[model samples]
Target: MLKNLGTARSIFLVAGFALVMGLLGPMPAGADENCREVSLPDGSVKIICQDDGGDEGSGGPGGGGSGGGERTCEFNESEIACSSEFGVWDGRCYARVASPQPPKSTPVWEGNDDGVILECNPPGCVGGPAPCPDRSFYWSPTAPAAPGPSAEELAQRAVAAMNLTMGEIGSTPPASTSDPNAVGTIGLPIWLWIADRAENTVGPITREESDGGLTVAATGTLERTEWTLTSASGATVGAITCDGPNAAGTPYDGRNSAEPSPTCGFGADLNSSPGSLTLTGTAHWVVEWQGGGQSGQITVPPQSNSTQVRIGELQALLRN
Candidate 1:
């Protein structure tokens, strides 16, 4: 007896075969047609193949009719297990991209004149339990055929693969001033910046990902840094934002020691009493991607890093 298939059950059953072995390896070189490698959920591998005349003495859906006689085929509700890297689409599993290029006239590839995307269509088997696609590839112009998935989707995938981050917050006066007892003076400038600039942090870093024949590359650059200044008592006092190419801010050198920070700095009116002020710096990044004849921008979640600063009033001394 075979389970009823809601959709194209006959086609899938007629052409597909599952090894059902404990562990299977990749399809060997020069393998037979209508076969592809599949990875199972339990970290095991299996091979699914489409076979001609695979259906033998098996009852049709619900075990009603004889198997050897004329078999009826119809689409039914059935779970199609796709390979790890593939996705199910339009009642068929699709690879990331079509290998060869489908003609512009292809109904599915109508608007896309760009590049090639590979497609593997499922054929019919008489009464096979598991149905998979044939190894033969087709040209679909659009990867997985457009309107299904777009380059932007791939771009987001690349961004996720990046695992981006922001560096620690640095200050001009240093979190702990040279004179431990001498805290930052109120009404004076406090410079904030990225402590360390690296590939993953505050970076103009680039990354790329490839699948089938399609490739996408993305670059992330620091756009700005927003600062929140809070008093020791947890009261919100000031908010400073630094933007532009120097979002990371200029590290304090001996030069221009008296002037305010040219790029990213502000004067705090509040003073730290029992506890020190908390300066939290949030990094903003803009990621731009270009691939498949398209380019776009993306903004990732803000990364935050904090440092503590103590501010106090400078006492003056008068001489007789």
Candidate 2:
């Protein structure tokens, strides 16, 4: 029996040793094939070399082989750690250093927590935000300044210069024939005198009061013979005797002196028929002195035979 047990035990022991050797192979050499490939949990793969040996695991090409297990990446505050070196890609950061990232672009519009829209231009790529386009809409051209004198002032000055007394006063019939009336008429003599020299003919008369001075103005034609002055003695004064251009003896067209002097002659006798003093004569005449503006004259006709002489007063008033 003992002899038989020894043979069986020898067989069993040999069989166990063969099984152990089959289960464990010898340590691989450095010269062995490197791991060719590896796969990560993220579904990415890598190649490794054979020389790294099966113990170091395998990945595709730089250290490519096969049979390495899956890898996982570990995340931390400073860096992202991985279960295996190949788990993190080349472009990714590791425990010690981080990879560079591209600059971020700014958005055109920003939103607040409440979801309201706001405008903003971020600095970076080109500099800052662009300015908004100009939006002005309306414009008006300036008006040119008005020209010349006001209408109102010109109208007033014009009305003040019109001649009316010449025709109105002289043409009126006496109040009564028996009254022996001697009413005089005043006028402007020439059209040229009125158009060019009327203002100059009359003395400078202002709106202001003068020191015991009076202004005399002539209207209508000077040749109408409408104006005269009588003395208190009941004598008739003749048409004014003017010197220079307006002189009585001098022709109407003749230019005598630079300034004209006009005088009046007196008429003789007085009528006591209806107790009226009939008088006829012209007294007032104006000549241009400083400026050659114009000249004026007042004429009177001879008294009617109904009255020998009549005394009348002469006066003048200015409008402007």
Per lDDT, the best of the predicted structures is: 1
TM-score of each: 0.51, 0.17
Per-residue error for 244 in candidate 1, Å, reads 1.5
Candidate 2 deviant stretches above 4 angstroms: 1-140, 150-178, 181-204, 207-263, 267-320
Error of 1 at 186 (Å): 1.6
lDDT score at residue 3, model 2, on the 0-100 scale: 89
For model 2, how does the per-residue alpha-carbon lDDT over 102-178 read when each residue is reduced to its tens digit?
Answer: 11221211111222111111111122222312101111122111122222222233324532221111111132343
Among these predictions, the greatest TM-score belongs to 1
lDDT of 1 by residue, 1-320 (tens): 35545346866654454443224544542385555454332323345554442322222211112132221222233322222233323233334454344455654443456655454434232233223434334334444433223457767888887777768777755675433663666766777778777877777888886543446789988888898878778887778888887788877775754567778877644323324777788888889998655689999999887767777666799999
Q: Candidate 1: lDDT over CA atoms?
A: 0.58
